[model samples]
Target: MTVRERLMYIAKNRYARRIPLTSRLKAVLRAYLHERGVIDNDNLFISVENKILGARSIQDRLRQYGNLTGVNNEVTVSPNAFRRTFCRLKVEAGTNIFVSQRLTGHQSLEILRRYVEIYGKDLEEAIEKGFEGL
Candidate 1:
């Protein structure tokens, strides 16, 4: 569940990031890799033509899958949406912002803050907790 590989973005920027995965996610990825069998390539995901999938292709495939599963109907599902959701979930789970930033490879807290949406309940809870120590 450790990400040690470099990820290349569409802008040709490459970055090596380490991300921790849940046990369930790790198991699912392992099963997927096992089912995929051995390939003579370093890419984790390949197209039906046995070629590396570019960022655009991956985004398109995700969008298509979301549409097929009727997820797009519920919300505009995209890769960015997944990123934002991940950030929000981490914050909601009370994970440290700095840890989330590292996991997400965000360069600054300002950029990471954009991905987090704080709810009214979260603010109310924070206020109560703040007063409890006063």
Candidate 2:
């Protein structure tokens, strides 16, 4: 599913109030929830205020867990990496840079662009595949 869809689903299942929701947004959320099932009550991806598992505490535990499970030189756990991953996925999916910046809560598109990079293999493969089709 798309990032926008995931965000809407998270907002919906967690927000049980009578808050407003766009019809299009509700449709996307319904599809995501139907596909993924409701996340575990204690899953560490939701917010604490929502009485669900969340990222803040999970991040702290991730650091400790990384140190324990990862090689000494490879042990690093960063919340920003998740943001970077989101940015990369959006860019690869043809999301505009401006939109990615807004979704990522970045102050500038310049900063957002720095998070995304064109992959050499993907570019090369596209050229090779085009030649094959020709």
Candidate 3:
């Protein structure tokens, strides 16, 4: 199954919740849980306070960790990095742009376009692959 179609289990608001996650992302989450020794919690991602992490909290903590690790000084630690990377990856992997936009919760194609950066190498590779039969 595709990553977009797989459901991930999590604890939220006094109930269980399931959200879509890619297989690779699922592995990453499982690895993090193993590393952190989390055995019982259903939430794949959580704060140090044992609370399930939401988008805002995850962003805040990511910023804090980036600052602590000196990543903030070298590169901006913002949601844009993740969002844009997600878009670029999805597009590169051949997912439809409109689908990526919906998955990313972007309201417009204009905003989504800003997130997707198509390098010359990507275009060249696509051309080569398409013309390989000839």
What are the C-alpha RMSDs, in order, of all predicted structures?
4.5, 8.8, 6.5
Candidate 3 lDDT over 18-72, as tens digits, reads 4567778778867886787845677767767777879788789889999999999
* Model 1: residue 56 alpha-carbon error in angstroms: 0.6
Give the total clashing residue pairs for model 2: 0
User: How accurate locally, in lDDT, is each candidate?
Assistant: 0.81, 0.65, 0.77
**CA displacement after TM-score superposition, residue 87 of candidate 1 (Å):** 0.1
The deviation in Å at residue 25 for candidate 3 is 2.0
Q: Per model, how many backbone clashes are there?
A: 0, 0, 1
In the predicted model 3, the residue pairs found to clash are 3-22
Specify the highest-lDDT model's number: 1
**lDDT tens readout by residue for model 1, 20-87:** 56677668878989999888888888987789988899889989999999999998777789989989
- Candidate 2 lDDT over residue span 41-131, tens digit each: 6342455354655556777776777778774356346667666877999888898878777666666777777888667997998899889
Q: TM-scores of the models, in the given order?
A: 0.75, 0.47, 0.56
- For model 2, the local distance difference test gives 0.65
Candidate 1 lDDT trough over 10 residues, lowest sum = 4-13
| Clashing residue pairs found in predicted model 1 | none
TM-score of candidate 2 relative to the true fold: 0.47
